[model samples]
Target: MTATAEPRVLKHQALRAQLETLLDGMSVGDPFPAERELAERYNVSRETVRQALRAVLLEGRIERRGRTTVVAQSKVVQPLMIGSYTEAALADGRSASRILVGLTQHTADAELAAALRIAPGAPIAQLERVLTTDGYRVGLETTRLPADRYPGMLDNFDHTSSLYAAIMARGIDFERTEETIDTTLPDAREAALLTVDARTPMFLLNRISYDQNDIPIEHRRSLYRGDRMTFTTTLRAG
Candidate 1:
């Protein structure tokens, strides 16, 4: 890169770090300064300020709400583990709740049956819900399981409680899971559920859980607000 371009990039990065440090002290409801004001304060062009804002926004440090940009907390970090969403939120020292969208039984189709290793047309339970923290919607989770695997699972499960406990009650223990994450802009349905713009970026997690016997017991597809959720992966030196 040219020396000219290098300085410009470094200046932008420095401004972003400055903005982030400023935001770290503010509470969630605190309003951010106007772009022009921020530019003047940072002694940068409005365009530079915008670029810095874009960097922080992509990092999920703050978000625009309605007509105003406000401070939001750092993304809720979700470690790869076999735990309920509530547990994940609590681990971050936040309260977690959910709004149940629906729970119903359906006949498992070819793909669903294969995924669960069940007979075709077997009964399956589909549960859809939104996960929230501090009264703000952050994610939509949809999970499916073979109904026969956990008889009367819906009838016995509390809608607001930990899914891990619910499954354990039915003697279905989940020992491990494989999860894959991908990114997309929220569609209309997802946007409405998450209370974000349709063009808002998001992460979609597809997790398949297995039992002690290595049998797939559940399939879950969760769409999380990219601006308010972050995922963590652990690595060890070999």
Candidate 2:
């Protein structure tokens, strides 16, 4: 009788399960055992240990800091509804903040004009900010609005505060929004600003919000870290 060999993938998967079990007992920011130590402890080759760690790393269970890998914090749960990042983070029991990168006014180009339903060369204000949760960089957002409609926006609006709140204070509330989500890799500038690798995966979001009159009020582009953010939505049956 011939004996069947165990598959290599199954071996690595078993090792991964053991590693996850070990992680359950570890605290966040605790350094993980070195690869050599893990290999020796598991009686497996170093290559197998490496293969087993890959999935855990991608799942955000572990992260590399300097030269050491350590247990990571849980990902922030973001609801796919009309809300601000600050509100979402708070719902997840986390604190959120922003670093204002730039705030300026410029004439709308053809693309922006079409999106905002305004004539070309109309004045628009752009607000760029970096979104952080619990002091860790997690996302980048850029918002554009018609400057004529919101006069003194660049000079009066506090960039660090919630844009949605500021808009509501002006007596304009968002009635609905159309959003599209996709996956992408960070560019060099974005990688630096987000403090992530250029190859790190990102969730790209494009949104256009409308008021009660069905007039577009805001246009925004946002990128969230794939490993640190998870989007959720409720489903309804018809």
Candidate 3:
């Protein structure tokens, strides 16, 4: 059974390579060839073509649109560094904007308290927004800050603008940040907000930003669509 499976795997891999080559010549949003046509051109069975196409789809080289598949737009590359989403999008030659979702004040729970190093019942200002790049919804972000530390933040801060800029305007600055990244699938509400399938994979980012005195000033949780964005970093050899 193992021997039989190996050849099938190799065949699909080879077919996937050919499909990628085909995609290289196509422009973004160009219609991908039908499976029947691909099978005929490659002299393979339709099932083999289907398997190859599935692999390509998973790689984000192509996407399903209604009843057709088309070449996908290049994923936005976000550097894993201290920067604002607007700054990163501008660097990529894309326009960035945000839709204000909600803004409210709440008392910090035990989990939030530990993360921000504040009292469990301390007043916290929570801001939620949907991030967009080039008019496409790409991420959702929720940011929490100590309400007492940033007085009038809920009323003065513009939810649609860069949060970092607003913080700087208040004479507050980020000295450093600690961030973690993981993968998750969106819930139904999140999927509807991001305009993605509920099964779509997402990049979950949690960050804690600190002041010059190493005090945690901000806690942020963000979710970015895996198909529309990617994270990059530079590593130095020690």
Candidate 4:
């Protein structure tokens, strides 16, 4: 390789190290060194700086929020692999705790029916809870499970624990899943539960979980603290 190639590789590696340092220290909204500053610090061209930052962006470590690429706190590196929520949280050293807000058995609505792939009038178990970190309210989740899957699911587990974990204990394969995430403003109930002011930007996560037979097992909507949590997905260059 030419001398130019070696420096290019070194600069990329250095940038990766710097980005990891930022992730380990800062929260979302924290600004990074200016592009010009990065070029100076790394002894590389501005183009190199841009390329390095693009790597971080692809990894969901940083985002273009405003005039700057801001660091994301708790960049949620969700693998394409299917795993339990509690497993992911504990593996990342995040405080995973829940408070039961409401529990009921009800007929599915239009939206729930569509997501759960069930009839509108089908019976479902509605589980609502608040998820917290370090004793601070961080998010809220409301899950709908078909009543036929678990005869008495609403009465089975304590709401403070992970429902997926509890469900697996019953020999149900709560193993496979799919998720879609978007940002949205919080409603009155969601705002109060998350302890954020109404209209605060939230990470709206819509998840669909399936069993081994590809049967929809869990349909859920969760609202996360936009400032404190960041969702990440890995992508490949096309």
Poorest 10 consecutive residues by lDDT, candidate 4 = 72-81
Task: Please provide, for model 2 over 89-192, each residue's C-alpha lDDT reduced to its tens digit, 9 standing for 90 to 100.
Answer: 88789999999999988899999899999999999999999999998888999999998898875687676688998888888889999999999999999989
Candidate 4 to native Cα RMSD, angstroms:
8.5
State residue 195's C-alpha deviation in candidate 2, in Å.
1.1
Stretches of candidate 2 off by over 4 Å are 1-12, 36-51
lDDT order of candidates, top first: 2, 3, 1, 4
- Model 2, residue 91: distance off in Å is 2.6
Ordered from best to worst TM-score, the candidate numbers read 2, 3, 1, 4
List where candidate 4 sits over 4 angstroms from the true fold. 1-81, 236-238
Each model's lDDT comes to 0.86, 0.89, 0.88, 0.74
User: C-alpha displacement of 56 in model 1, angstroms?
Assistant: 1.5
- Cα misplacement distance, residue 42 of candidate 3 (Å): 5.3
For residues 47-110, what per-residue lDDT tens digits would candidate 1 score against the true structure? Answer: 8988898788888877888877898776788787888889888978998999999998899899
State the lDDT at 45 in candidate 3.
Answer: 93
Comparing 3 and 4 on lDDT, the stronger one: 3
RMSD for each model, in Å, please? Answer: 3.2, 3.8, 3.6, 8.5
